[model samples]
Target: MRTRKSETELPRFGEAEALRLDAADPGHRHLFHVPPADGGRHPESAYLAGNSLGLQPRATRDELLADLDAWGRLGVEGHLEAERPWLPYHELLTAPAARLVGALPTETVVMNSLTVNLHLLMVSFYRPTGTRTRIVIEDSAFPSDSYAVRSQARFHGLDPDTTVVRLTPRPGEDTLRTEDVTAFLAAEGDTVALVMLGGVNYLTGELMDIPAITAAGRAAGAVVGWDLAHAAGNVPLSLHEWDVDFAAWCSYKYLNSGPGALGGVFVHERHHGEPDLPRFEGWWSTAAATRFEMTPVSRPPSTVEAWQISNPPIFSMGPVRTSLELFDSVGMPALRDRSLRLTGYLERLLDEVTADRPLTVITPRDPGRRGCQLSVRLGEGSARELTKRLRYEHGVIADAREPDVVRFAPVPLYSTYHDCWRVADALAATVGRAG
Candidate 1:
């Protein structure tokens, strides 16, 4: 909550202004642990990497320990006797996760990791037949999706290079345009079997036009699915209303679960009871009431739970529950409001800092087209090296992509206005102006 004095203070841009903004609009930073600075005069690091991984909630430790203690006391009985019973532990997360992403509880389930859920959802949705064997994704998609789709192509005995269509931005553009995507589908949609893309691009931080794209893909007769790894907790979504066929998202980032936490999947109610849909199932895939029958064959539910393949790790569910509860208590509408204000402030600071520097903000200028993250591409220095200098010398925690991009996310739940000012300050100090 403290602001440092700066000799570079100007009329519109100054650390004092940042402090006043924080005093007027404080986030829920007290609920989480802001890491100690590794290298600057400031005691706390300017943590801005939530797009990669979120800070741990203070409640996570105590809540996780409680789950552990239940096991120690009740042994196998913990399955039914624990405070938050293990047998139905995942059920605790269903509605809240559903609310967070704007889906019916029957249409959502927290299950495996992000990419695993993608592959599983693809099994049921990505049905390639005849000439419609192609899968569409953006060129800047996170690498895991590229691998998943490519492997899917190969599994069907198709060439990944040809079967996977990567939509690239136009000449000199850093992000894809929705009109371009829809036009591509209009021209080439019949050849595409599935359209899967990141709801928000990982590198450029572009929040794609989900509803428009989903409508286009469906109108083109292609199944549309989104990897909301970056969009889930960052932006508001309405998968059910969007008429999306399927979607998946990881919890580790904006969801604020620990590293590699379980992910959530959404399958529209329309797809739930389709008799011909092939799904990989296990005991957990069956209805809870029928789960203990021990029958040779499974009776899968007519809900999204039918996609779940295994009993989730209860310990992992604890952190996700803790984080989702925080989201539920504060609500996405409030967080998003703060996000727009916080990110807008950061953009202004970067505007001043990069005015004479060789840095370029690659994320879209429109707040409506992006989330909490702002990505900058350096014109001279290595982004990796720039981040290192920002960290060791200035105590700013940021994420860098190889070549020349660095990402900063001013998460509304915890990131402060001072955090944004530090990013601008660090950039100015580390990357000297282009003279």
Candidate 2:
């Protein structure tokens, strides 16, 4: 039962070190109930797939049950009379959501899923004019994002091939260099109507230089936006201070909301009151005071809420509210501090375990360039079969990408140092068998 070293000290490997690190972690891992291993053969399996879907918070059950009780008791009146009045329930998440991303309350809103929000935000931000008729995105962005942006270009009657500009990394590189992005924007920024990228690349787990890239895009006369699906809760963001034009993120990943939980969006305060900013509007987007009037003209609110298309889904929002409460209590600074150490520990362990194997960590080595997740590239091995073996043989859950990559995300909230050790051990065994 060795004690873990302090953050300033170097990390060591082995079960004793894992236990010590877990003991030192301020984040309460017990708050989450990890699923038992296959056939209840082992204790909770090493769940390291938070990059795809986070482990659920125990509080979510109570919160969702409360919402159900309100629905049963109040019937149609639940919208107004629920315990946390459904009508204004979304407002409860506004401030906390804003705080998670370093934005003003007025500049953020929790709403539809990630891609939906992206489309809505693009309607206003991507105003392809005569000369500036293209959108810029990273070539390795999440498939959904690539599809959304390409479809958006086609929706504007522009050809996706010529209108969608993809910025790729230099040859044989796994991640994009900030200088390359800045240079790309400098050269083609004027012709680009919008520069939208994943604040963190999902495939490689590369955290982009959002502020610097945003500044470069703006300086080049292009609107800048971000798909923060992987970045939002994984890293500390200053969306407001960065002067980013718009951004959207899903809650299911690092935020620990249930699968397909509602997403959040941020619009700078400067754009809130812009009367001429063209956006697709709906009933819920109208100002709260005049929302019930059913007026002929749609008077969209001046805040980010103006992007809403339908009434907030109370059931879906309940889990998000519960999860955000945990984030509010723990605070991002503390979570981030724990996250850096945990991921670093995992990186070191991976290097040690795979030293003799064909596994290579594609994620950046620099702490500043990545988040909790690490993408491991498998050479001369089937990533799909190895991923299955990790789950079936060792009870480790990680995600696999097509061809040859597997992603493991050690979420700060519930993941442990021991979880990192178990994953590494499982990976070593799996790779040995594959070889």
Candidate 3:
């Protein structure tokens, strides 16, 4: 068990300070497998790239092996005879996933990858009619989301160039302001069939105001949805309370479910049981009790499971179940408290180290406006080379976005304040060399 520290017990930027903070952190580094040093030239990497991919949990191996054993021993019977039967395997994650996102169990389901679920939800929510035919998204949205939305428009026989609205940050701004978003809705809300934005942006690490944006879009008579690939497991969410219509997220990032793990979806209860709501459905989506009856009639369940198009992938879901169990154990509230302090500590250390450098933090400084990530804009040099040096020489794992930005996400679950200090120290050295 880990000991809790009062807010006053938090430390400043230093090795001792990081050690102290790590000592008090309920989510310890031992829970993960930090990348090993290469040929003893450097220490274990100070991994600050959870924004792209999270480190694997130690328990993931055991969880997967158990499923393998079941598959070998039970054969087809594994669906109902194994320890954790594969037939209803996805149900195990529903409660924990709902807890992580602050939604009721019936409102959530774990299936498909992030973009696929978004497309699936859009099929139902993005009802582009005669006038309300536009789909709204940010200019800096992940390429996959952009493609999905644009393709969705084309699928409806609408020209994407004219029908898709891209909300961009103002002149001389790095992040989108909520005011700008609301203002766009005010002007073109009636024309928008769906308002889909990243809950936390991938490039800027900016946490958008979901409730405000959702309410604004709804007021403008548009269905609102969120792509939470970066926000889930990194911040506190109240999707139900916020009145968000639908949302989807991948588990491979902060959720620490290995790469390509199953994704989760949230469909607000208000949309459930509405027969008029258009959605794609399949056998697994029907009521389980009568699913095997193989009747031609489609009796979709009265829950979010009605959106599931196929049966659960038991192997892919094993690691996710293990990861969600950890979230359930520690809870999002405690994890979020630690994330604020850890990221704040990273910000301070970056300021101290880069005070004389040409780098600038583009991520929002306000705690409520961001998650664990801090995206720094590099000046006077190549970001790719600096990122390379940070990894090969200093053993710091950070991601570099093309042309200018380097992103560092010090996850509260396995990263330490000392890790934050090391990242800054390594970055300072790299920048000094480049200069």
The model with the greater TM-score, 1 or 2, is 1
Q: Please, what are the lDDT tens digits per residue for candidate 2 over residues 74-154?
A: 998988888799999999999999999999999999999999999999989999899999999999988999899999999
Residue range 106-197, candidate 1, lDDT tens digits? 99999889999999999999899999999999999999999999999999899999999999999999999999999999999999999999
> What is the lDDT for 429 in model 2?
55
lDDT, ranked from best to worst: 1, 3, 2
Model 2: colliding residue pairs: none
Off by over 4 Å in 2: 1-12, 39-41, 433-435
Rank by TM-score, descending? Answer: 1, 2, 3
| Top lDDT model | 1
Runs of candidate 1 with Cα error greater than 4 angstroms are 1-12
TM-score of each: 0.97, 0.95, 0.95
Candidate no. 2 TM-score: 0.95
Instruction: Indicate whether candidate 2 or candidate 3 has the larger lDDT.
Output: 3
